[model samples]
Target: MSFFVSDRAPANRVSGYKRRIVLYCLGALLLLLVAVAMGAAIGETAIPLDVIGKTVANRIFGAGYTLDPIEEGIVWSYRISRAIVAASCGAALAVSGAVLQSLLRNPLADPYLLGLSAGASTGAVLVTVIGIGGGMVSLSVGAFWGAALAFGLVALLAKAAGGGVSAQGTGQIILAGIAGSQLFNALTSFIITRSANAEQARGIMFWLLGNLSGVRWDDVWLAVPVAVGGVAVCIWHMRALDAFAFGADSAASLGIPVRRVQVVLIAITALMTAVMVSLVGSIGFVGLVIPHAARFLVGVRHGRLLPVTALTGAVFLVIADIVSRTAIPGQVVPIGVITALVGAPGFALILIRGRRMR
Candidate 1:
């Protein structure tokens, strides 16, 4: 009997791949659970871990636990919801960043690359400052529509500028996004400067800087589904992301429809970014910082990179949220502020590492 060495090698490789995937999934799940638990248990008012666990069981599984109504209410109503939204938002933005980076081949590419943040800010300002919706639309709805409008404008600009999906076209899209961002940002500033009262200006500014104070169960419901779907879509197209990272010509040669994949993935990322921005305001640093961190750890293969990036981001933002609440006693800093504080330094480190690698 001859030993089939060739077959053994292929089978072994397949086994290793499956093992890596399983290990990654389990590790990510464990860390995420721990981070969520930490966020729920530690805050301005600390809730006991047992109480939180019991409250979650009672609320989610109908576990009969004789717990304080106040503790249960806090756990079920505010903290848990906030933690869930933070995780969802962080995961969405980070995955969007990773996808954009791979697709655009720009280390700096982020969910806001297509002017979503600027547009959302302008839209929120329009609703709050200009009263465009006349109290009919909430800030979240206005911001979301604004983001959608911005995405459309950017796409039109990129196409009209004569860059389809070539390497040159990648730069074209980035330029178009920059121009659109400037226009919307200017509009937001103008409205705030000319129309908004001090209180209104303050409120919009805080929201634009990112605030999770108002996150509730409704937000969790909205954010969780969007995050899950967007991430699933990205994972499903993992091959396309890797292909795009090489070049459009290469992706096309590989039978990947370059333009279609580009458009669909960008739209999905925009939706993820827009929804998260709507829920939590325009949180910065997450989309820009998390992907690079993930890439540094996992290398360039998107199959491994995407999920690690998302989990890292989820944990990072949950921790950031905790810091924002606890950094200054009795005063909740903007979540954006905490992220910026960490991200700016992290960005510098990434640059240093990149230069060294070069």
Candidate 2:
């Protein structure tokens, strides 16, 4: 596998690199475990860490001290599901962002930048306004189709601009993505405006802003498959992502199979985006910010970057959820809102740093 490992020291330096990778992976794993525990422990009712651990153990193996039905329900039904949702969505968005930045060869590439979120929102909005499923599955399906359409349109437009399905410059793709996003976003707004119910309008608006409240195990089932599949696809095409970083022609010359891989990645990303957005509306800075943060931690190897990005994303989302719920008394902010506030400034800093480096 001629893929970039992000940390590629010479053979003589292999031992040191190996140690670093192991430690990094271990640290990320520890962070994930802590985040999960902490996320489960900090809801409105406030389960202690020991209780949280006991609840998890009981749920997993029936070996720990048992709680009453109410406590069990809170732990099993509310906190665990919520924590899982946070971890899954965060990991999915972060990895998606990382893959997108590499694939687009632009630091700013994200689900929104590629119109996947908007497209998925369009589909989801269609079902919501028109009435799709009575439940989460129906919503997820609608969002999936919306994302597919958005990404499909962007891909087609990019192809047309370059005279074929080839990787154009970052500028072309980003511009095309922006155009696609605007078109879909407009369509979504139109749908909301035409809706007869005020509640529906509010729902649509909240969905766009993103939230992880009311998460159920059903949402977990819907999100996990898509996230896992997308991660697998990214791993398989790690080399292609690296090739893309050097530019399309360079990737092609290196036998990276640019167009085919590009299509595959876009499809994977679109599906994952739809799943995520449907479950938790349009969480913005996650895809934009977490990848860069994780990259700084893990260097830039896709093998390492892919996993670490996912882990950091999970941690970031969990912490964000904690703050969203606990930052104010008797009030909970939307997770997406918190992430954007946190992400946007740091993202700007990254851009400034990039410019300075140049």
Best candidate, TM-score: 1
Q: What is the lDDT of candidate 2?
A: 0.80
Pairs with steric clashes in candidate 2: 5-301, 6-301, 119-146, 120-146, 120-147
- How does residue 317 of candidate 2 score in lDDT? 90
lDDT by residue (7-78, candidate 2, tens digit) is 454663888888987898788778888898888888677877777767777888887686766877787788
The residue-by-residue lDDT of candidate 1 on 1-358, one tens digit each, is 2479876988999999999879878988999999999999998899889999999899889999999998888888988899999999999999999998888888888888899999999989999888887899999999999999998999889988987445457888898899999999999999999999999999999999999999999888899999999999998899988888778888899999888888788889999999999889988989999999988898888888888888999999999999999999999899999999999999999999899999
lDDT of candidate 2 at residue 348, scale 0 to 100: 92
Q: Give the TM-score of candidate 1.
A: 0.95
Candidate 1's displacement at residue 54, Å, is 0.4
